[model samples]
Target: MISVQGLTKTYGGFRAVDDVSFVAAPGRVTGFLGPNGAGKSTTMRMMTGLTVPTSGRATIGGHAYRDIPNPGRHVGVLLDASAQHAGRTGREVLALGAGVLDLPRSRVDEMLETVSLTRQEARRRVKDYSLGMRQRLGIAHALLGDPEVLVLDEPANGLDPAGIHWMRTLLTDYARRGGTVLLSSHLLHEVEVIADDLVVIGQGRIVAQGTKTELLQSTGTVVRAVDDAALERALAEAGISSVASPDGARRTEAEARQVGEAAAHHGVVLLELRAADGAGLEELFLTLTSQTQREGAAA
Candidate 1:
């Protein structure tokens, strides 16, 4: 298991990561999510000991990452797919990693096959590899040691739909075999499909963290009426607070029965009323991190 407790990092007056705490349990895949500049990468760096934290701690199996012997054999990490040496071939890259971990050279061939990199491609220099191919090579190196824990950042950044499907299957199977996986990605739909738990960060702090079901469960009721202004007024008069959704519907924490009764008492005609349970991960993510997103910056 990976435990991050009050992990924080600051640069001068700026707090890159602030009081972040979450656990990636064994036999589960935890999806780390945040908008641009919300400190997702910073938190991951702290967890892997790539950056020093101003306070708190991150540990794997009750030991700090740097303190673990032959860490690659226990914790697989792929923070940057493109950070490999440009002068080396894909096969050479994995070979060096295997040597560092004291793994057998044959492990390199097995990992190349595991990630579906053709032998011909492996013979080419990493500088000639496309972004998608680099991603595959990086994954291969991360898995070469058959570690119990995996921490990957944006592993699907350059994959096609089929490649994305393959990655999803691979990670899910790893977790099924009792390996811990902590994945960070901008692909919300894919995360929704495979992640068992979610940790959402905004402004360098954790905004939400829980099992997928608990986080995605309906938080309120959604209702629409012929007269939106009148419905709003009715709800206000009934002491129920609501927010208008993009579809001209109002979502409130009040139950459906309460909303319907309020509309009826106000002599308002209701067009639709239901539990607001259909919001998917994209909607929830946007809603949770809307304020943290930069105005005109690319994520």
Candidate 2:
């Protein structure tokens, strides 16, 4: 398991990560999400000990990452797929990693196969590899030690649809075998499909974190009327509160039936009325982080 408790990182007056806490439990894949500049990378850096935190801590199992012996054997990390040595062959890269973990050289071949990097491709220098190939090589290196925990940041960045599907299957299977996976990505749909839980961050703080079901479950009804002002007034008179959604529709905690009745009673022309059941991760992510994005845009 990975436990991050009140992890905060500050550079001068700027707080890159602030009081972030979440758990990536064993046998589960936790998707870490945030918009641009919302500190997703910073938090991941802290967890992997790439950056020092101003306060709090992050640990794998019960020990800090730095304290773990041969950490690659216990926690596999791939924070940057393109950070590999440009002069090294893909095979050479994994070989060096295996050496660091004191694993047999054969482990390099095993991992290359596991990530679908053919022998011919692995023989080429990393500098000549395309982004997708680099991603495959990075994943191969991460799995070289067969670690119990995996922390990957944007592992799907350069993958095609088929490659993305392959990655999803691989990580899900890894978790099924009782390993823990913490994945950070901007690919909302991919995350929605594979993540068992979610941690949403904005402005350097955790805005929300929970099982995917709990966070994505419908909280209300979404309705849009030809006369939006009239609909709002009607709902207000009925004591049902509502907020305007990003798309100009009104979302209310009341049931769809209740919203419909109120609109009908007020002679409001309804254009759309539905339960918010399938809003999905994209909507939830935007709603949770919208304020931070607006602030960022303003600045």
Query: Highest TM-score, which number?
Result: 1
What is the C-alpha RMSD, rounded to one decimal, of candidate 2? Answer: 4.7
TM-score of each: 0.86, 0.85
Best prediction by lDDT: 1
lDDT of 2 by residue, 1-299 (tens): 99999999999999989899999999999999998888989888888888989999999998998999998999889899999999999999999999989999999889988889999999999999999999999888888888999999999999999999999999999999999999999899999999999999999999889999998888778899998889988998998767677687977667899999999999999999988865578777765665576543212
What would you estimate as the lDDT of candidate 2? 0.89
Task: List candidate 2 segments past 4 Å from native.
Answer: 221-275, 294-299
Clashing residue pairs in candidate 1 (N, C-alpha, C atoms within 3 angstroms): none
Q: How accurate is candidate 1 locally (lDDT)?
A: 0.91
